[model samples]
Target: MEAYCSMKAQEVRKLIREQVITGQTSGMATGFTQANLVILKQEHALDFLLFCQRNPKSCPLLDVTEPGSYRPAKLAEGADIRSELPSYRIYRDGVLAEEVNDITDYWEDDMVGFLIGCSFTFEAPLLAGGIPIRHIEENRNVPMYKTNIACTKSGIFEGPTVVSMRPMKAQDAIRAIQITTRFPDVHGAPIHLGDPSLIGIDDVSAPDFGDAVTINEGEIPVFWACGVTPQAVAMQSKPSIMITHSPGCMFISDRKDSELSVL
Candidate 1:
């Protein structure tokens, strides 16, 4: 894990493309930015772009690929979006059809890929600030849940907002808010803190996506809008087809985390 944390983004991406690394990417490629992927046909691209524009917090744009091009020019150079990510989820008519290590078979000439900012980009700063990320400590994926809070609809895109949670003490939570606020592209700041029930989470121990972690006494759960929100939207919107990174498995980009930070 330590070796992976110190590796360059391109090295990590190479391993992933070869299917050597096929799991969550939380602590890998420490200082680089990571992104969530969303692929749709050219016809649906405009509507989805509008969807992302309206829900900036959950779907902040990182770099979008040109139609028929698998390369994310702005985020990664000489990297193929079709296979660079560890894992992918294929959706057909809004229903998840299959999970694959590569999407080359599904790629279309008119397909447009959208790279959304991922919260993993901000985890390094949180750790540097002395905040212990329980999921990282436990070697598990960060827990994510679907909230009752509805996202602003754009075209056929409409669904409940999704969020990822981290447990920390009150002081650490406050510090995290300040540190993360600098990176709005990466789902900056906690949208909700304390009780999960307030956000329609029935049980914090059972998350809608990813793995659950220990929440110590006196520690509160901090919720941040998640890039996975698009997955939920895909289910609701029922597009003809969509492809995305599986929950927690992200595309490691050449861009540095600091590049996305406002500070």
Candidate 2:
């Protein structure tokens, strides 16, 4: 079975290239640094680059492709951005127009690619700390929502930061904060906890992306700034064109999860 194989991240990337897999990448490339992808035309690269810098929590830049280039120079070699991802979202002037498994048809000489750190990279550490993540236990993607919290605006990109939620007992929640603080590269530490309404989240059951899992009694909902914030902001920013990995579908980086350890 695919789950039984202790495969390397590179091997998993090969499968994505073959199109044998077509679904969210969450929990798949375990121990590898999974990242959120963003692509935009070169004309907006300066503004967008500044935007990411201003909103580091939501858009921690990883590796970026040069203008008009597809091959990622430092992240992955021989990696095809247009086909490696299981799915892609195409936005025109900042509106969702289509979702596809590949984007070779959408590639242009003026486009640039960006990789952002994802919370999935922290799942391993949380598990190691004995803090259970409900979504993984339920075999569903993590729940995400757009919050009322606004990120620092950069250039033409300015929008509320989105976040992913996980419920935990009070004591475990405290320990989780300590454990996750070490992994800032991936989302480090919970931003808000306890009441969702404090962050403008009305209903925890209705998630913006991914499926919701059971929240036990006495558990508090903890929120973390999400990589999706950038994508959602791009949707509202209405850039001439934008592309990003589908929700839960991320680019598997060659770096080891421990390589991301801030020690």
Candidate 3:
């Protein structure tokens, strides 16, 4: 795992293309911006875009594809949406049919893919700040929870906001807020800090999606609006056709993480 941990973006894609990497891609491509994949039909493009805008906290706008465009022009050049990602979920009228290593068979002429930002891009900064990401340290998926907070509505896409939790000490939590605020395009800043129940999270030990991490005493839970929001929202809407990277598997982009910085 350590050998693959420092792999290049192209190398990571090769593993994904060859179906060699089956698990989550949280820490594989260190410096590159790993994006959340969302594919939809042309008809839902405008509505979904607006939903992303209205709920920018949960859905920061990234690169959107033109109708029938599978290749992302802004994030990763010469990258295929079908094969670059490790795993994809096929949603039929809002129900998940099955998980697959690729999605070439379901491709449509009017399908457009989106590459939204993910918090995985910020691990470099957080670790530099001496804040340990529980999942990365534990070799497990980051804990994600569905919050009681409702996302701002835009057209047909609307649902509860979902957040990823990373337990940190009080001082580290403050530093995290400062560090993340610099990267607004990647779901900047912590939306909620401390007390899981305050944000509709009943138990910190359990998560709606992903594996749970141990929270040490004197460390508080910090929550950030996650890239998973789109998948959760898209599932509820159930468009005729919608595709997303399976949880923990993300699309590796050619763009550097620092390029996403506002300052």
Highest-lDDT candidate: 1
Measured with C-alpha atoms, the lDDT of residue 203 in candidate 2 is 92
lDDT of 2 at 242: 93
How many clashing pairs does model 1 include?
0
Compared with the true structure, what per-residue lDDT tens digits does model 3 show for residues 158-205? 778999999999999999999999899899998999888998999878
Rank candidates by lDDT, best first: 1, 3, 2
Off by over 4 Å in 2: 1-5
At residue 2, what lDDT does model 3 achieve? 70
Per-residue CA lDDT of model 2 for 61-174, tens digit only, reads 878998888887677877778888889998898889899998999999999999889998888888988899999899888899899999888788889989999999999899
Each prediction's TM-score against the native?
0.96, 0.95, 0.96
Better of 2 and 3 by lDDT: 3
Candidate 2, poorest ten consecutive residues by summed lDDT: 1-10
Q: How far is candidate 1 from the true structure (C-alpha RMSD, Å)?
A: 1.3
lDDT of each: 0.92, 0.86, 0.87
User: Model 3, residue 225: what's the lDDT?
Assistant: 98
Greater TM-score among 1 and 2 belongs to 1
